[model samples]
Target: MTGMRILAVAGGYPGWRAQALRALAAGWPPDAVTWTESDALPASAAGQMTLDYAPAPPAQTCAVAEPAAPVPAAPVRISRDFAALLQHAALYRSTQRWALLYRALWRWQNGDRSVASAADHDGARLHAMAKAVRRARHDMIAYVRFQQRAGGGMPEYLAWYEPGHDVLASAAEHFARRMGKSSWWIGTPHGSALWDGQAMHLSGLPADPAAMPATADQVEPLWLAYYQSIFNPARLNEAALVQHMPVRFWKGLPEGPLIPAMIAQARAGARRVGQAAAVGEMPGKPVPMEAGRAQPPRALPSTLDQCRRCELWRHATQAVPGCGPQGARIMLVGEQPGDQEDLAGQPFIGPAGQVLDDALRRAELARETVYLTNAVKHFKWVARGKRRMHKTPGQREVEACAAWLEEEIARVKPRVIVALGATALRAVLRRAAALQDHLDAPVLRGDALVMATYHPSYALRVQGVRTPAQVAAHIAETLARARQLAEATLPA
Candidate 1:
């Protein structure tokens, strides 16, 4: 302590690393030296420097070199991961940080591996600081909102932030990668970071973060509208929101003002249990869930395309409504429409449709003479490479389309209703029965004699049990049976 040197660093990772390495190489133990941040940096750690707010202790030196190199100590080694962790923890704004790091490094270098394990006291402290710094970096990246501004020697975009840790320099690189050649400035109370498209410039401490001049984003209104539209009141969790996004940051966010009002509205009585306020104001009827309670049914054909009865309508091209002359004595109901039928906005017009057309012709029944439709009007498909391969409609989707199927039977007054597949069987009978159990058998539903068989698409499936010829024959036989039943069951 009689003639000790206070090593000065210009500040930041590079500055600290240089001094730490020199201190290690000089064989000067951690207790033999002091560290300080300096604006007047000397030639090296061995030369004199004037302290310039290092956030550590004040320097007590008068043009003195740290300590004479007493044969360089054996080069110390640390894991690459621990080295990186040291770099992050170095940014923590604590006066004891420099001493803490040196103690850990000295212990680890001297065969005490416990110094690098979080279970140890020094290791736990080191790891905690690093974790905190990492979180601060992430928060800066997540919350910094850049607004584009008119150009006049100003960057293309500008933002203001106040991160808890000194992470502006490290976090600015994230915006550069995402913004893609866009120049920007992020001003903070402790520091400011700027990217000039090609490279970044970082400076310590800005005059005032409030003095950060910029215009509001031109697209902010649109963004606010989108944000509001998706803000589900029913799912609002105020505590979690505040925990994740601290109130200190709210002042800088564009949507900050709206969040409180929206949350307030959400907590108000009945409004707390429903959709976004903007969406609840939308003009749409509640889809009829119960026949007894619902308003009189709308004309089903005219309204099927607007059906929000199921989410299936979203992917479908359009509702493939039942086609052919109304009042037909036979209604041939298949499963959902096939690919071509979905695109053409007409039923029974795809490969399966081709099979149906030939089957109807061979059954001695004209296509125009019978009502043709599907139990589920929307084509449910999942993308397979470039094509939309058929996916069976879930039970929920099948039940959702049941009302439309029921209305179709009533309108057509079909004495015979052919349930072309299992979906058709479920929709028409309002029950779950395997197609195999009901195939070639007719069950009575109200005035209609409902029959079930293999859908025409069953034949189109590769290496199917039923050949293309066999499928067409089965469909033709079902149609023939339906026609025979319609003629035999004469009206009273």
Candidate 2:
């Protein structure tokens, strides 16, 4: 082997090429062999060995093959994990992938079993390549929207996808298993897969996107509506969304084009929620203004269960209404109910509520003297595994619940209203304004002297600015000020 002996195999089948690689590696020194996908080899290289390859044997049979031990006592030791990793890495589009896999296999044969460890340079590179291949496969499975073709017998389904790696064949079994009874075809730029309810056939011929039917399925509208409904404006993280579903796959996704408009509408809807609450039209019902015609303040608790102003009620256990005397002189409003509050059907009983109670005791303010409530009555959350993660209520949700908050204010008529956080501040102000702008001083909104302060939750989250002792001290100072203002403004 004066020079590298080039070996080329037909592309698109990782198992077929892997078989050729193993046969060559077993006989020749890894350094003397240069492997390349046949499609990539130059036309002038006619002298290079083009191996007649076939798919490798089943995993059990191919697990380990010890030939009459090589002249150099080191026998090629291959594990199932190593073989699988190499196969996946071979699907990568890199020109140097063949050489890299050969080198790693050579190391494994030379008694270095830890070549697959992330600590090794070749191992790290292989891991990254394998990760990319896995992600491409997952994306293919997730974003492939099958459009039901118009037919009579055994309804055929067609889907168009563009995978970043050579994953069409690797991912075919998944679609086959998932759509067992249905006949489907998944076409990609590199190849296509056809499943006929029983067996799957793969082809290397590239698919033309224009050749696919452009007609939308009947259920597309329903899917788009559902997609729009679940998109939380408050929890929008575009970067994370794009990371999981790359923009490259957007062309094939039915919901992709709607993202920009949906995001814009969410922002606009948030603004409208704030503005609607600012005026007296929130909850979209006209306020009856006949004297003595108002519903009894005490009846609000029972009526809250019937409230369906927003979608939050759909998931929450029950509405957690305001908990305090009807004529309390001080009102404390928080953002919304947390997990514990939602479950107990009570406000200010969770960890944040405990912090509030402690702060009230420190400030010489009794919890009984203040009306405790949240701007949004129902709990908004998204399920993560077994736990329900809290999601911030969008402005529309706040606006929808504004009628309840307004009624509470009318019933209590507190001299001083303490907005606990940004949500509470927005509810009271009826417009979007930063909490920091009003933190240092009191602002008068209508008949109430509105004061903004850090919610107990925020105080709990404060790592800097002071110790836990200092957090309590700060809360005490704010409450002390609230008390003085309430007293001075009472019927003066």
Candidate 3:
């Protein structure tokens, strides 16, 4: 094998590395041979028609030739960074890729460390190719849409793809870990990868058209509808969208056909709200009514500070417990803690706190004498923009925190319990007691007299029945009435 030797490699790095090692040991320089893929043959190069050695083993080492006098094989050392770059570049499809890799390897082995750096001409191309392969890997992961198999055979899911590089084997691992134990098949023009629960196998098999439907279960239609509904013509940036998701991939997506029409409509409508109908008009899943829930594994934790009765504790800063003299004569029960109250771990210290202080002053009642607490201990809120806005607690949450309110009431033993709002009214009497209807009356619960009124925070907002100032005046009068009742009806 002397003049113009042709080196045929199976595929990529492993196959070439084994053959390259034998070529190097036989004293073949990079320019001495023309490298070609096993399936491709070049008719332009003239040669003596000499051939390279047979296929080598998968191990990244040179195969020893059985010469009359066997020569010892020497180890070639390379940096870890260079080794990784070479592997990534192998995924790039090119006719002269083998020769370029061999030239870099030979130069590195001969003590030119700069050959692998980007400053060198060959290094720049290597890095660019590696970057393209990396982007292609990401594209495959993001774009592959798996459809449920028609017959539910060995592979439960099926997806067809067309990636620019040879990355099916590498990208398949991502789906394997995500879909765990659920078999899947991802077929491509280059090859196919089948995950059969335990392991993944690679082959040249094409995808079966019968097994894959255009729309995979009912999910595709729902997904397309959602994508179309949320696509605001007012915010669409066509250039940026195409840059991120290339036009080549649109053919495979379920919503692909709708994109062109959507763009055309947006252009015609001049980016207005009239192009698409309101989201409320589109069909959506109805909220479940009185959905039953499983009882927690155990009752509330031993202490109120560590209570896990509901998920409210997960996001709250801390539980705001009732604070006042243990045996106060009057107990004021509000809805729940606000933002500032949650952080301080004490009751009545937010916007509602200011309103309460004004009411106490107007009523000629001291704040220290009245016990302060809430029906729910933790803060309930949902995020809006950068701030945490308040949200009303659900009936289930109210039920979970009932025990805490019960303990507080028993400990205080108040003669008069003022229910600040409907939440406190229901939690105290353990029933649906409307605040508007019972505002001027007093009801009995256990040993205490329960009175209903607007919560202190109600003074901060406009009301249909009263102004903020009017609401504040009414609260003061309610508190004064409760105080008189407490003074008159005392236990011996």
Candidate 4:
């Protein structure tokens, strides 16, 4: 048999294309007629094999010409690393383009053209490879451990991580620059890079060395205990847990050893909550009541100026009591006190309230005619060095202060109540729905119409985003709808 002629093809560069050419050469005899970029062959044989090369234009582009000879399939193996490369490649290209790259790679690797060219196999292969790469990369990042290196001054701690793609490098660099004042190193398998307060230094992948804090105070055990104790078994999603907290992350997690135990404890904790709910010991259990009888607080205070039922009272500069006429037509419920509200002991005096006031004005509603108070009386916040950041009240926190909310509702007796978000919705309606879905929906609580809408803070945050104008419009629309609904429901 005449030695089958073989031609090596590469995109560009010598050393970089060496592996691909050598791989092709291995499948064919060396004497099959070697041809370099300059080598010219007989016209008859040259016409049979075609290598299309277009003039290098200033603008980047690739064009493929027709081949006279059928290209033999090149054999290639799909390893886990290759799958990772495919995933990174996908992020830079469109889905269709990624599909093409995978198809090209797979067809070249698999010798059988029929198998590689099959539509079903090609599509499935591409999808499988892409998924594998994404998952592998996520695992690598989620689990990779870093050590605190010596000789790096100023940066309190240092760690290393290898990323699958360059996509996260910028984010990592940004985090390192902001979070670390001293030197820090992030190592990838491809290379390692270090950021000293002033400059970035590059190095090869570091040797794997066991790392531990110099101090004897390892917090993993205690942290693991607390984490395990808090684990909710009912929310145990093995797939989600693995996806989010992959095994790779275990080594870095202080409480990594306790995950299985924590998972078990979480299940037990869920059972306990269920049992407590069954026996009426659960926190925030809805109090059953007789119809028409307002469940007022057993003891009513003359002035809500001072009430300390929770820790929120300690930090929230002051308690903002309910305000307005006793029989106001509308009652507006808010989440909690803002920094200014906490200080002034008033609900609508803060930036958030100002925004709400503007919306109310735009909607042709009188802010003075509406009774205003928060579902939560106390301010819950985290103190950053000096500034206090408002924190969302948990169900337990909300219910702990429900006595005040009930007292306010009983005293005011507003005809229409507006629930601001999940927090206020829970207080008013005793149920919570997706806030976005029920934005303009009127929830009926007895005869009063309860409308749920995005909180003013939500609108304020949305204002800075891509859909700022749309979000602002939605806020106006929803508020206007609430006033319209309030008017229709209130008897003339």
Candidate 5:
């Protein structure tokens, strides 16, 4: 019989007749017959068979049935003398023959005339071959790739690639369990894996490309939409994208629709980026100076009133403005809005202020003798259940609150300013200094001497770890020195 020969291959367990294989078979000669097996076969004509025609089976074991008679079980026959001898032996011949033989012949090339070595070698080889076959079969199932196609009101993936192993059955089950209602197909050079939303099936490869289904319509469009949305024009890396998502994947994606638009945007974006870099490289123009360089008058006030900017105004009973005689010798600055300060709307009324007040009393300084105000005018807090927890204001918030502090500074015009911790230091001086660098040391801001020290809250938190009494004594000593400086510089 003369006809175009066709070979069908598959992975995992076989399924019903392959639809693609049947479609491809229609145009072939009448004498052609399909043979399904777990072996790879090459295309060849009887007379024109070439070197490629001799295809070896894939490195896998196949369960094939050939008509043959079943062998009957035979009874074991043993001599009474041999049986008695074996019973008294240290090792049984059935389980421990190899051990017995090895022990019996320990000499060099000990020619003990028994088929034991040959039998053992054969057994070992058989075991290895079986293991290889099983592994190859498994790999064949796992590595197959399938293309997606649309049919019967559902979308599916259908493509053919020669799998190097048997991984399809498990792969199908994984997807089936995860997406129970979805239908998909995986076609391998050997076979195809099909999931009809309920169960999976494996079958033979098709001969013709036309027999395969068309590409899915919805898949391409959805893919392209997602790709475009995530394409970040600001950081579009063409090389990186191509490296991660290769050209091969583009054929299966909606990338074609976005390619031209992306290219145009990328070029424009690159030019703008370059221009900005050039501008940044150029030196900034200097502004003309007006006056000591002319000093603006400070609009300092002695009391908190008519203050409204943040949400703090809504909750705080009153605005806790600065308190002190105008032109007081010493000015003290602190963080804003303690619980009591928020309620009283006054600075130096909270526990830390109470601590300061007590320290001042012990140091023999009058409570109303020095300038007292917060670095920030308003309270900044976040809601936590029923309580409002204080949140440090951001840089912009600090800048907004600076006007009130500046007013206080203008009114007081003290000879010395005492910044209580990092926050106070930044608010008063308009710059942040490292605690380690400026602790105990004062930074001069124009004519005013700015002294730095730990905030009362820091001392309070570490009370158990270190003695609060010692901390209070240290603060008193710093204040005493500040008082002396104030008296010497602005004797009142």
Candidate 6:
């Protein structure tokens, strides 16, 4: 241990520090190397290596009459996934994080190829620490509320945050990208980041929280008023609200204090609405059908529009019903409608639908020959500015809408059903199951052959990692397999 060399770094620069790790691993034994980013190094350290933040000097090569045989470089292999994890874990506050990452990397470089598995203790520890760092970065980005200076020169904004990890440097990039051409400063317990319209600078020393303004801004009241208006009395989930926006962040947020009062008002308003409904004096237009009552049979799409089985109907414009031949051999069930589908009152009409259409064409399956429907009838969404972003429906909501789906299934009587995503898979199976488990494989559920496949929307979400053509190929393959299964189940 006394013979080992120590490498001192300025912490938070994982990429530069990684170069040192690679150099050490290629030169010395793992046990004979010590990496430190602390303020002071051990007194007994035999040798020292300092990692400079600035660009390094170009290497100078000198000719030697008898060049010593180059020491064989130790085999060091790191996967892109593991490298990303190590970079994230470097921001963790744990003192042993550097050692842990090195040990994992060493094991990976050695014969142990399973070093990246979560089942391995070191790998699991690294993942957990990386997860914490990632969460802290997310929290910093979400909770850091910038307040404008009273008498601003070039319009400066300031915010004070207390992140659980060393994430100020990592999270600063997000603010820089989001608030382009605007100057802002975010101070944390560990450090501070300053953005000046053009560039971002990170200071290693902690900034005094007192420097931030404590007074409320003029826009806060308007924000609170808007929050109150949008706070749905019908859906009051305090536990969920607190989980997403933790109590620890309440101090920094402007609408924090108003939450309690808003919840109270929401409860009271819900009670009033309940009382009004009980007396048949509803707040809005009365729903044609009673809540939770079994819907009556009507062989028309207009009747499905009058459904009130779930709260989804209250928010969505209309119920998006299945379309195609009534007795088609194949039925494709998607999770739910999107903004386009909700507006059009039809299934598979959004960007996801376009992808599905392309895949169907590639699979040689005629669009008119197959039935298209959704597991859930209505489009569930949360408003973001003017956009209605899609929201996954809860299991309870899925169950509530199951009756309509069952009606469609009975009407269609398709020999083969394709569940397009986890939500649709759960709906069709009547039990929770992973999409990967049944993909491209048919499972006979009584008389119908049910197959699972990635949803078109999922392909859209993963398009950055996987090309659109690749995703379409996968969807096409799944559909082709489903068509073959359908034909096999048909009467010979």
Clashes of each: 0, 1, 0, 8, 24, 0
Off by over 4 Å in 4: 1-306, 463-466, 489-492
**lDDT by residue for model 4 over 1-492, one digit each (tens)?**
222332332321232134333423333322232333323334564444433222222211212222233444543565565444444444332224322443445345654444332255554555555555566555555455444545434344555454444333433455565656666556555455566667766553342433313223233334443464355565578789887776765755566777877667656665565455446634675667875565445554455643544566555555777788788767888888777766555687777887788878887788887898888887788879998888999887787678788777877776678877679888887656677666766766776777777677876676344464565556566667766665675644
Global lDDT scores for all candidate models = 0.77, 0.77, 0.82, 0.58, 0.56, 0.77
Deviation in Å, model 5, residue 126 alpha carbon: 99
TM-score (C-alpha) between model 2 and the true structure:
0.51
Per-residue lDDT of 298 in model 3: 70
Better of 3 and 4 by lDDT: 3
lDDT of 5 by residue, 1-492 (tens): 223333343322122123222212222212233333324344443343211111423312211222132222332233454333222231111223222322222211123323122245533333343344455444433333345564544436554544333444445566567657677666544456668887777675543435657665544444453465455455666788666544444443346547657768768775466466457668978777786564565454344443434445555445567788888988888877676666554577767887898778776778788988877776777789988777776667666578888877887888889887778888888986765566678778877888877777666766465688877887787788888888885423
What number of backbone clashes does candidate 2 have, counting pairs of residues 3 or more apart or in separate chains?
Answer: 1
lDDT (Cα, tens digit) per residue for candidate 6, span 1-492: 223444455655454355455444344444545567657566644334322222332323111112232323655557899888878888888667767777776676656767687788988888898888898889988889988865676438888889999888878999899999999888887788999999888898879977755445766755664565456655678899988989899988888888877679767777566455456633666568775574555443347765666689778777788999988989999999998777667789789999999999988999999999999998899999999999999998898778888888888898999999899999998998988888866787767889888889887777466776676788899898878877874543
| Runs off by more than 4 Å, candidate 2 | 11-27, 47-75, 152-155, 212-214, 266-492
Give the per-residue lDDT of model 1 (tens digit) for 17-117.
77777667655677776766665434564533433233434334333345553635577789998888788888887767777787777776767888878
Q: What TM value does model 4 have?
A: 0.38
TM-score per prediction, in order, is 0.52, 0.51, 0.52, 0.38, 0.37, 0.48
Error of 5 at 155 (Å): 86
Spell out the clash pairs found in candidate 2. Answer: 278-430
Candidates ranked by lDDT, best first? 3, 1, 2, 6, 4, 5
Q: Pick the candidate with the highest TM-score.
A: 3
lDDT of 2 by residue, 268-374 (tens): 77545545544744356677686666733433334886676677877877788998988887899999999888776778988899988988887789998899999
